[model samples]
Target chain A: MEDNKIQEVKSPSLITTPSGGWGASVHVFAPATVANVVCGFDVLGFAVNEPGDEVIMRMTGKPGITISKITGDDGRLPLDPAKNTVSVSVQHYLQSVGRADVGLDIELHKKMPIGSGLGSSSASTVAGLFAIKTLLGDEADPAKLLPFAMKGEEMACGQGHADNVAPALLGGFVLIRSYEPLDVVRLPHPAGLWCAIVFPDVDVPTREARQIIRKNIQMKDAVTQWGNIAGLVSGLFMQDIDLIGRSMKDVLVEPVRSMLIPDFYKMREMAMGMGAVSFGISGSGPSVFAFTKDEETARLITQKLQQHLTGLKIGSNTYVSTINDAGPRVLG
Target chain B: MEDNKIQEVKSPSLITTPSGGWGASVHVFAPATVANVVCGFDVLGFAVNEPGDEVIMRMTGKPGITISKITGDDGRLPLDPAKNTVSVSVQHYLQSVGRADVGLDIELHKKMPIGSGLGSSSASTVAGLFAIKTLLGDEADPAKLLPFAMKGEEMACGQGHADNVAPALLGGFVLIRSYEPLDVVRLPHPAGLWCAIVFPDVDVPTREARQIIRKNIQMKDAVTQWGNIAGLVSGLFMQDIDLIGRSMKDVLVEPVRSMLIPDFYKMREMAMGMGAVSFGISGSGPSVFAFTKDEETARLITQKLQQHLTGLKIGSNTYVSTINDAGPRVLG
Candidate 1:
């Protein structure tokens, strides 16, 4: 690994393509993210290790961005470059860097379920952007890509929230400290932290889930929510798992959103009974997640939750993994 | 300091008094605290080094709690033990430990201003409780006295909130994560954090200050507030002064409460101009605090704020100190 005699791969790229373009194609994978983590509402999220999306990008002679192929989206995602979140965000990135004239062929592979409340669109968008940046050999900081990804989020979901896209782009647990200034802080997490995710097959539109929440909340509830929010963040810093469990409560959003998800309370009770550290709706939700201290408990929680969903005659996908420390990775 | 030949003080006490009583008197000092810290509202507070209360307690031959003397309020405080916060809290503590028969006389010395929005009553109550505990040489945990101290808060403030008392008892910055189970977490802080507190002369009752706030708040504002709360806590842990400054904004309470204080916005503007890290109304109204990196800046800001208050023909007191790491101490 320390061999200085290793051949430089980028020298060949400079001969084949223009100054800003890559000679070879690049494939990138971005992890799925869980937004609105319990009491965090529109501020906090974390990326998971499994169930992500992949994007393949390569420069071409044609002048414009195009989606050559898209898979596993059930033909629901847009094919047009202007309309699709992946292409639109990538186009924005290219425009910002004065490379809008660069031609590119993009292929999106949705390895995760759509509308699963697990930041599916964010994964796809981040993967596409990461692929382009990798191909260009861009040394710019990864956080610089967040605004473009948030634009993708705005296109996908009417709101430009960073809870999902920020974590998907930066990895680990993230706190969107401010929206106007777009201050996103990547926080430290306990090494033993594992997430148990269950995407139950239920048709709950994100718009409808958002509409169901109360626009005006009591001051008492807001006080409670911020307290828990502080506690959860403190727990992450202190690496105290029990404090995290105690503080992962959502009195504002969960009470109303839970009505859309069948057996939400029952699943929470069962998850907690099985030693799950904390459990709550993931994002706007038909999906849910439970935090655990070990991989074994996380796996057990997913298994039990999937079984419960099955008993209700509902299909579900389950995943057990630690937090994704690295945001996006390059694939051959 | 490591000498094992140090005299054991408890041996002489055992011969003169019964199991639950002490022969000698104890004098205690508890630091004043700033509650409702910016975006934290009712859930966060921290102790300051100056302007605290002192309590002197001694065991008597009589059988009940008594307030023998009260000073520094111009006779505003009550002499009756049942009505006074200090004696009432100490009585509750005595009852909880099955020592109601243990006689006590507490002298209340108000070192801090009353109703200055600086938790004056909480300091006195905590000081009284700490004095009794010290006299008895109680080996019980300090946190065990929180419930009893909170009763005094209920009598003084009409709400059993622990934002003031918790920090006064535990020292440092504290977060009351939940009110039901009464969970308090002491958070880490930046070592060089200094506070500039200016208590302007005004008559803003706590009840009226609270009643002025909107019971129902917009969801967007709540989200913003919690994001700032998380950011503030994270900044404290990460020791990021800039992040803490950016996140100390309070959109809900400050807007309404600032109206009660004269020239609140102008002071904030002046303090920010003078290199203060953050500025906001401390506790509720009348008193305001500015955070700064060093003691010199804190002292300067307080002087300017006091000068401004004087220009308006309003009397004010100023304090410059670091966060009090120790909650209460024996004066003698």
Candidate 2:
């Protein structure tokens, strides 16, 4: 029956047929991202090495898309292709390329925790899209797929911003210059710069975390925020680690969002006291990240933070890695 | 009697004596600056080569400060030592160094239009400070005098911001990362960038220009503004001219301030249509500026803008130059 179905696929392009047949499969891994980057709010983000997501996609003869499996999400994610971010985003990408008739099966493996404020959904969505792109032998730039990935983000969260998906797609530090035309630029950074991310096992809903932020910020505070944003970008371009640390300050969102995570201030003090260069809440919070100059310090700070979270009787996970310079890669 | 005044002075530092006498004079030139730089608001600025001010300072045996002459200001500037920005700022520097009793005479030559929004007062104040520093053989870094220069800014305008004074004193493009501790850093830029400045003969009081701006802005707009700020800084660092042009957009202040300048939108259209890279209000702005790649284009844009202002029955002044890498220099 499956062989008979293969005959019905009308001329799947030669580029899509590696073995001159329809059962080609590809696997891809996409890095998780940290958005806002302290003072940047919705304008800045970066990719990290660990706690990412993997997607396996295979071409089928049927004229539709299906999600075969989703793991490590504790049944929190929807299995329906209509409701799932990965399948929905892949469908969007297919339609965009005039390949809506292509049939595929997707499997999302969440290597990271869900709702950790570590861009888990963005990672999954990017991974799925990357897998499909790889399977179809598409030669388009990965950044060209960003808009489709952002659609998945819009479905996962209420607002459609490129901060998370951009870094996750392009790698390194990314500055979203504008949203109207969707301008995103990759910035330079110090080679030795490292990030220490700790995801505390606290549930801070994305909607409520966003709602807690002041929509109407004071003009003076806004000036301070932009100053730091300019400084951070300058620091990155200059490759001055100390300046980057000094500029990693948030006067708008963190002050309010920090309240959602228990012992947030104490953890920050500990991180700074342990020689971390800078500290701030990641994404919408419950997860937080600190920066350091070397892998040793990054690991030490993460261990210290995880210990502090344990002292508060809260479970936590820790990861220490330099910035992920390569966004995504074919695993097999 | 003239010789008797020198004997009355208590042991002055030998560094102050250049000709083995109490009488020494120094002349200095300080360039004008463009603050806000479009999207930067209060955090970014850069120096320009033309339309600057000159200060001539002469050490005297008398035990007080005096403003001996002022020129080219249409008698709009004050000659009183206590009231004038140059003399007032010089006094602050003198008091800081515990040399308030040292006698000096200052001559301010306003080479640029007064209240042109081209940082006229900042150029004058920086010139005076530079003149004093050079005359005294003070080998300290020129940036150390920024606070003294900022005092003159506070006296000229109500607020004390480093956007103008920092670039005027430090040269090159500058970013004021924070105000509390006054962190200012110079940024690198492409060598070929040129500016076309046009100061229309009109009044747009700095205080009123500031007052007209919204005190509280929507978070979305602030995000957009900071995104552009980051993009501009990154563009400067990357030496990407088109990126810089695309990022030189102001969502907060320019909307309100443009109303003050006649035919502001039309002028912007003309400049942009004529191959200008970017255009915006230079400071609080009766003065406007556009950036171009070469000297010829800069001069042509300025000429065209002046003609447009002339069509409106308004008088104007125009200057064209590249970014000023040297902030202030000793004339003699």
DockQ of each: 0.80, 0.77
lDDT of 2 by residue, A1-332 (tens): 00100111223242454553588898899998999999999889999988799999888999899889988889999989999989999998887777888899888899999888889999999999888877777775677778888889999988887889989988999888888777888988899999999999989988789998888989999999999999889889878877888888999999999999889899999989988989999999889999998899899988988888888899999999899989988898
Span of 10 residues, lowest total lDDT, candidate 2 chain A: A1-10
The numbered model that scores best in DockQ is 1
Candidate 2 per-residue lDDT, tens place, B1-332, comes to 01100111123232455552568888899999999999999888999999899999998998789998999999999889989999999898888787877899999999999888989999999999998888787776677788889899999998887788888998889888988767787899999899999999999998899999999999989999999999899889878888899999998999999999999999999999889999999989989999999989988899998998999999999999999999998888
TM (chain A) per model = 0.94, 0.94
Candidate 2 regions off by >4 Å? Answer: A1-16, B1-16
In the predicted model 2, the residue pairs found to clash are none
Candidate 2 chain B TM?
0.94
Task: Give DockQ: model 1.
Answer: 0.80
RMSD after CA superposition, every candidate: 6.1, 7.1
Q: Write the per-residue lDDT of candidate 1 for residues A196-244, one digit (tens) a residue.
A: 9999998888888889999999999999999999999999998988889
Clashing pairs in 1: none
